[model samples]
Target: TEADPLADAVAAAVAEANEPQPSAPTGPPLPGGEKDAFRVAVGQCWNVGSLSTDALGTTVVVAVAMQETGVPDGGSIRMLSFSGGSEAAALQAFEAARRAIIRCGARGFPLPVEKFSQWRDIEMTFNPEGMQFR
Candidate 1:
């Protein structure tokens, strides 16, 4: 009887441990209503078409580090990762992502100042295939 009780407790513990747990949010979700704002801000500043006509189906992950002052450090914006249709496409993706930062960074991302703390670091995926952010 004692062994049966012990086995049941062990089984229950194992099941509890195996139960799925929600993942922690990687970075702050763009505040409500700011999604469009962020998109527009990046789009207006992004000019990578000339950089890579071959980057038709490429995606680049850009990481932006937000300072407490609501401004991104000059060297904080960088390419975290990328995927492309080809080797050349991958290069183009990086170029395009870099250019976006150079052009749009001077004015700082259009992120709301109040929410800067939430997005201390933002890893955004730029998908040129659909010209959308993921």
Candidate 2:
């Protein structure tokens, strides 16, 4: 089959989206290292008490587009993919993920204003394995 430019472009875009993000440039380092800072900021509001056991154990990758001002574009928040549970359970997990982002980030994350491009969009994996349940 001949190479389709549109297909190739879409594939490249998908590949770039799935790749891990580069770390922030050197300056004021985030409190818990560069990468983990994103996690710690959003993870604090992840309340799993109401989630099912299956949901709590599942990992869901959530994606969101952001404004330059550090606020996540509300309509862009969505679950990209999930595993280790039924779709129903994954939905539960995704809701928790959504809540965490919306709750803790209502005022927007404390990302550096100058480096907005670095975080204009992000996909974060919410894995419950490391969380401590009550």
Candidate 3:
């Protein structure tokens, strides 16, 4: 089966956000430090039907949460929260939760990549099942 474009985009975005930084010098570790906190929780379940129309919606929700909480990197948050930590880990938890929800939604009902071009044309509905002329 072909990869879902929306899911691929979201995964790429999250991966980019979580990429390791090379410049931070080793020093006295930050107080209350922990291991990789960024991750998607598996046991927690969600109804994909409740998520927005596409992965973009999910990405937006995650980005907003990250902006609000100030942790753009997902791994740190995943490790701290799911691994057992504080409520301070809630925002990260939300991000992971939203992403998972969207991912599940995408898996259950994928959007077609061909629909992307429709955004440029008002007449285009981006409906894959719609009629095509010869």
Ranking by TM-score: 2, 1, 3
Which is the winner by TM-score between candidate 1 and candidate 3?
1
Question: On residues 19-123, what C-alpha lDDT tens digit does candidate 3 reach at each position?
Answer: 865443233442221111122121123323333333213211122112222222233223222223234343434554546534433333222233322111111
Clash pairs of candidate 2?
Answer: none
For candidate 2, lDDT tens digit of each residue in 1-134? 89999999999999999886665443343344655776787878888889899998799999998776778888899999999999999999999989888888888887876666566778999888865434
TM-score of each candidate? 0.62, 0.72, 0.20
For candidate 1, give the lDDT of residue 36: 62
Q: Which whole-number lDDT from 0 to 100 does residue 37 have in model 1?
A: 67
lDDT of the candidates, in the order given: 0.67, 0.82, 0.32
The lDDT, on a scale of 0 to 1, for candidate 1 is: 0.67
Per-prediction backbone clash count: 0, 0, 7
The alpha-carbon lDDT assigned to residue 81 of candidate 3 equals: 22
After superposing candidate 1 on the true structure, give the runs of residues whose Cα lies further than 4 Å from its correct spot: 1-29, 132-134
Task: Identify the runs in model 3 with alpha carbons over 4 angstroms from their true place.
Answer: 1-60, 64-89, 92-96, 102-108, 117-134
**Could you tell me how far off, in angstroms, the CA of residue 1 lies in candidate 3 after the best superposition?**
56
- Top candidate on TM-score is 2
Candidate 3 lDDT score relative to the true structure: 0.32
Question: In terms of lDDT, which candidate is strongest?
Answer: 2
